[model samples]
Target: MVQAVPDPRRWKALALLCGAFFMVILDSAIVVVALPSIEIDLGFAPSDLQWVLSAYALTFGGLLLLGGRSADLLGRRRMFMVGLALFTAASLLCALAWSPAALIAARAFQGVGAAVLTPTALSIVTTTFEEGPERNKALGIWGALGGVGGTAGWLIGGPLTDISWEWIFLINLPIGVTALALAPRLLRESRAQGQRRGFDPLGALSATAALVLMVYAVVEAPQAGWTGAQTVGLLAASLAMFVLFTVIESRVAQPLLPLRILRSWTLVGANVTMLVFSTIAFGMPFILTLYAQQVLGYSAVEFGLSSIVFPLAVTVAAIVGQGLVLKAGFRLVATAGLTLLGIGCLYLTQVSAGGSYFGDIFLGLLVSGLGVGLTFVTCSIAALAGVDEREAGLASGLSNTTFQIGAAVGVAIVSTVAVSRTDDVVAGGGEPIVALVEGHQAGFLAATILAGIGILSALLLLRRPPVPSPDQPPLVPVAEHADD
Candidate 1:
């Protein structure tokens, strides 16, 4: 059988798919900056506000594996269209929602759509492009777009929220509609060519329940007393469910998660590294935005503008990292990137209530962005490097799952630390605002620790350049032959 090349039309399809992915990723951060406005306009309690973000993330992360598997069993193009339609419809519902419950519900559905779409999108890209530098370059752009979209979300969201928070959802509608129209004309469908398997409903249920319970426990611990029955009960339940999931996976004939993938040290390390980096990357926006608005008293627009530093740096670093990986090697550049990320997080630990934005915050964001940018590309490449074409969908799903889980865990851990410290400062008779700032500083410190741990993991887990297969040509290190 002649190997199939990606249809030229698939390039356009990939672009549209990425555009949709960008919208979803961008929405995650866009809402963070608009949360205050959302709360005031929508009459949301402080306790309920977290769900505005959490609802989307929980559902998206929870259903990712199902979505990926569905793509393989069904068709990538079909799943992509279905996901886009659902996402677009949910966005409309979100824009029209008058009550907090309605908005949260809509957001959850949005997550469902995102879960369906993300893995299928990646699977499509992997299937369309051959496994080599071409795919690496494409995946590099995909990863870079995610980083860029996150930053753009805030920058655009601030201005859009000023116009109307509803505009954010409404905006995705047109783009989504355009993508849906273009998709049929441009995209080709692909799936596994062999025996079909039934969906593992039990495994899916157990895994979703485990993740949600765990995330809920962590999220609630910051608000509810950690010793409270509700917190303890949820945490206990989460642990039990996770243990149950492992047992179920081992017993099931068709496991939702193929446990064997963990045997690949490169894949395991990349997933763990992604988790750590994602945590810092996602959690920092929450901390920094708080610092800007509450501590420095910057307007939303000013804060959004300041936040641009990191994404711009990430965009630059992503391009450079891709070039470097083509020459030096993923190991060297990735280690360096992780180290920069640790340094940047550590730098932010010095930030205080009186810190200047330009002097302290901007530089920290830039350094962290560059570090994360480099690592994101390298880790993504490393994760997918040796994956078989048949197993590409599974690998992509697992990788994306780790990214989501890491983000949730990062936010939860950092938030818990900050909230605990803030409570202490408040109990000490400090001003409420001052206590809040101190809590944020403590969170950044915790984030620094997390990033430092990631660096150590990268050093310990990642090996030198991977040995090529006998049938395959020796792979040149991207960083070694950099033109620049």
Candidate 2:
């Protein structure tokens, strides 16, 4: 048996890949702080403004599976470049958009590009690094970048929006172009070995449609009312499409997502944990954004600055979490992370209508940030731990898809809960500020419960340790591989 030569440029490639991924994650949250400017410049109706966000989420989440599978069947490097090109082009379109409709259309296009780009980029990382401690370290950095991208969006968006809302999208141009030029030089072309070119169009269509409808339903549920006809009808349709997707996958010679992958209890558990983790991770920040802007009367930039503690804590914790995972294993790290997340949310429930940032928001965010950092690294490692080389892209796609869906579900759950509570208080003629604070507190309480569920998911579902296949080395602690 012959061992393959390691790519000399792999580390540099990982840097580029992570950089591009950071941009994708950044785009998701950056536009959020700039929404008011966008609304004014484009004369968007309140109802239509959300579509700018939803458009990106819908396409990105929907196309991830297809994109991942395509990378497997096609060449990973080829798909990466293609996706990058599309994303960069769409960014330009978004900047140039003069009307709400144009911007929404461009944002959706941008998502299509992201859906293709994200999973493929992750697959590249897994393929580039050998499994075990080295891979875990790389993924830790990856997880940290995700946390930073989301946090920095608020920080960066505020100043950019002040200059001009279009700067947010325009900013991607140079980054994208530079990456495109560097990619061919750095990334080696690879694909699933011995896989035939046969494609599963029906399975792909059904799965993509199911995901798109599901994301749309959840994203719109708060506005439409959860029990309203539109919500129910869309959900039912989404469910039916999912059923069809499953049926198609079971029968197809080459399925988009092989059903057998679900048999891996470790992978399944990691994705479930990811979904639950994202609910709290995404939901808590959302409520805080409202609390800072609405209740504390902070401007976007001020809120961004005040909120910097969270990302800083997350970055430090994530680096530490990599070492912890390499020493203690996935289950312990994940469990501890969730415990902190729940405690953090519980602390946040003490927020008052007139609370100060240092007194109320800082500590909770810091605690939650630490938990987020650890849990993200743990989940990222666990998701691809025992995956086969051939299905690396599929695994990456599934992991990302879980995160995206979890984000949508999280925001919806919190928004619905908070709005209902706030409406009740307002109906009773309570002070608006007090009612708003109570609503945010309710949202934080919900996050605390979700974090608890995440802990259980980690304990129960991730019980069996990952068993490496015959071809690969078993995952070992960093101490064992320090010299590598």
Candidate 3:
């Protein structure tokens, strides 16, 4: 049995958790915005540049389940502090990196730390805060931190890179140190009761290898050509390994991810939604940054400032959405968010080379941000809704893993669509500028179609919110009818 966490220090614990989460989220965007500077200074090739992003994402996604399980077995507070220490040390290594290869390796280590830290942070929140308005507010703030950190990363990265690309990584040191220091005093230690249990090392290794291969294939497919033998072979291998992992998990005594959780409708729906939403949400900003700098002729700082509008809108909408969730429920709020996202993507299809930034781009960004904020918070609440305290770590891992995979897929798909369209337009004798503009517009149009499918999925799959449990404080607000 999991011990009930005391309420007196709950808010302080939440603050520490969010602080850790902010550092993780901050790194995700900061590195991307600073990439150009790093490339210029380190002489990175275009192919090698992809590794800067892929290295972190692949490792983070691959190890998330293991990280979550470790938190359960090792104690959330303990694992969280350990993760922060590793992450901070890795950040310093990243700052001091002298070569592209060195930086990539450091980033991978940093991802390991993030993977260990992230899900545990969510699990802490779930265990500490009772469900209902308080939990909703906490999750809302958690979601907002991600949005805010991502947006702020661009702003900070631009200025920091101008001073020194190293600052982007070095900045995390102080924040991590603070969180590490405060965690032991403010946070309660919790772990699964079972002892003398064996871990399924085979299952973990296989699953991690499978996901890494899959993500690598997707990330490389656009540059290598989808029909390339390397892409095809790796993708097939990924599928095979994934199948093997599933079989192993079913028979393993202590699987990294418990298969039983998939039976829960809310959990499944939430994961699916996260996968789709994250793909679009994370991918769009990458493409847009290129458009702003390479195409629109904006400086790094100017481009970062422009990028802020979307996430700022997301933060505001997330706060409002949380309040609405308390009154209207997850299903309704998520549906509305998905609908807005679809519309925002469709609006983006109207973007053109001749378009004005304020009139066309900003409006679309604001709309999309609002939709993303609303969807993220609602999906988070729904995913954890009614989850048993013992399973909170797994639940957090599952949802986050879906989002990570979805983000990788989204970037791959969008990049492929844009590149292919550009080639076609250029082959037809269109001007280079025309081809570039058309390719971007086409990509956004494709994203809109995908968002529409997600909207339909949310509407059809999710139902009314579950009632709060009397025995448990309202901290985990999962639905009563959640498939056990």
Candidate 4:
């Protein structure tokens, strides 16, 4: 039997794949600091501002399963380049957007591209590196890039937005074009050998509609009244669409989301915990962005720089968490992470109108960052546990979907609550700064509740793998590589 010859360009391919992955992840976070500038420039209504973020997340999350399946049916490299072109075009549209609606629409387009790009990129990475140390190293690099991209968003967005909000989106153009040019030379084409070519666009559409409508209803609830016909009707329609998605999934020849995948209790638990975990991870930064700018009167650059502690702490702690997961299993690490998350959010509630960053925000950000790092790493390990190798791409796609969905939902919930509270306080003739502080505090409290639920999910839903005897190595040293 002859052994297979490895691709000589695998490392170069890995670099390109990781670079694209970094850009996709960066887009998710890059808009954070730029939100205020975007709102001002684009005349975005407070209620509609989140659409900039949620629109991207909704489409990204909703279409991911389809994207993954498509990559399997089509060629991974082809889909990747197509996604790259689309994403680059959409970024240009976002930068040139003249109105809120236009920007939101463009962002949704970008998400579609991301939906196609991210999973396919990960698939390519997995296929490029032979399983074992090499693959693990590639995955580790992939995962670390996600963290760095996320952290870089704040730092990069601030300076860019300081110059002009459009710069944040414009920066993607050069990177995307460079990657597109090199992809053919560096990355080989691959696909699932015997998969059917059928698609479930309806399943994807229904799910997206459900999430978009749900977020729309929540974002509008403050002004429309929670129980008003508009809110109630939209919520009902969202539910109906969700039910329709499930039905379509059940009957489809090639379902976008394979229901059987959920049978793995660990995967289910991990995804569920991840859903809540992301609510906090994505929600906190949004509220802080507003609070820092609106209440504390920090410039975009200042807020971005000061908030560096959060992601820095997250990166550092994630490195430390890798070790902890080796000692204790995912269950304990996830629980502890969430506990810390809840405590951090609870601590943040003490923030006041005139409070300083160090006195009021630094500790909470540090603690929450640590929690975010640990929870994401451990929960990811749990999510992939026990899945068959063939379905690895599907499982990874599903996990990524859960995360984006959580981001959409979390931003909706926190933004709605904060805006509503601020409106009420302002209506009562409260000082604007104080009202803003109260609103931020409310948002933090909501995040704390999310963290508490995450803690419960970790404790109750995640299964405990049997401890290996002293002779055997840890059942799996999963901490080395995490799914972002």
> Which candidate ranks first by lDDT, i.e. highest?
2
* Candidate 4 worst ten-residue window by lDDT: 475-484
The total of clashing pairs for model 1 equals 14
Report each candidate's C-alpha RMSD, comma-separated, in the order given: 5.3, 4.6, 4.3, 4.7
Q: Give TM per candidate.
A: 0.92, 0.91, 0.92, 0.91
The lDDT per prediction is 0.79, 0.83, 0.79, 0.82
Question: Residue 421 CA error for candidate 4 (Å)?
Answer: 0.6
Q: lDDT, candidate 2, residue 448? A: 94
What is the C-alpha lDDT profile of model 4 across 1-484, one tens digit per residue? Answer: 1223567788899999989988998999999999999999989988789889999999999888888777766777888999899999999999999999899999999999999998888777766665534554555456556766776798888989999999999999999999999998888776665568788879988988998899889888999999999999999999999999989988888888888888888889989998999888888888888888888888889988887887787776666665565468778988988998889989998889888999988899888877877787666556655554345567767877888989999999998899899888999999888888899999999999999889998998987633335564221111111121
lDDT by residue for model 1 (205-258), tens: 887888889878887886788899989999899889888888988888777777
By TM-score, the best candidate is 1
Error of 2 at 341 (Å): 1.9
How many clashes (backbone atoms < 3 Å, residues ≥3 apart in a chain or on different chains) does model 4 have?
Answer: 0
Model 3 regions lying over 4 Å from their true place: 1-5, 195-197, 423-431, 469-484
| Candidate 3 residue 451 C-alpha distance from true site, Å | 1.3
Q: What is the lDDT of residue 81 in candidate 3?
A: 87
In each prediction, how many residue pairs overlap at the backbone (N, C-alpha, C within less than 3 A)?
Answer: 14, 0, 8, 0
**Per-residue lDDT of 211 in model 4:** 85
CA lDDT of 7 in candidate 1? 70
lDDT of 3 by residue, 1-484 (tens): 2334456877878888888898898888787677767888989974466577767877787778888888777788888888889899999999999999999999999988988899889988887787667887899899888777766788888888778989999999899988888987888777655444456778778977887788778667766778999999999999999999999989888898779988888888888887888777766666666566656777677777777877788899888887887688777888888778778877877777776688667877888888988998888888888787777888898777787777667766666677678878999999988888788877787788778877876877776568865674544322212121
> Candidate 2's residue-wise lDDT over 93-144, tens digit each?
9999999989999998998899889999999888888886788788989999
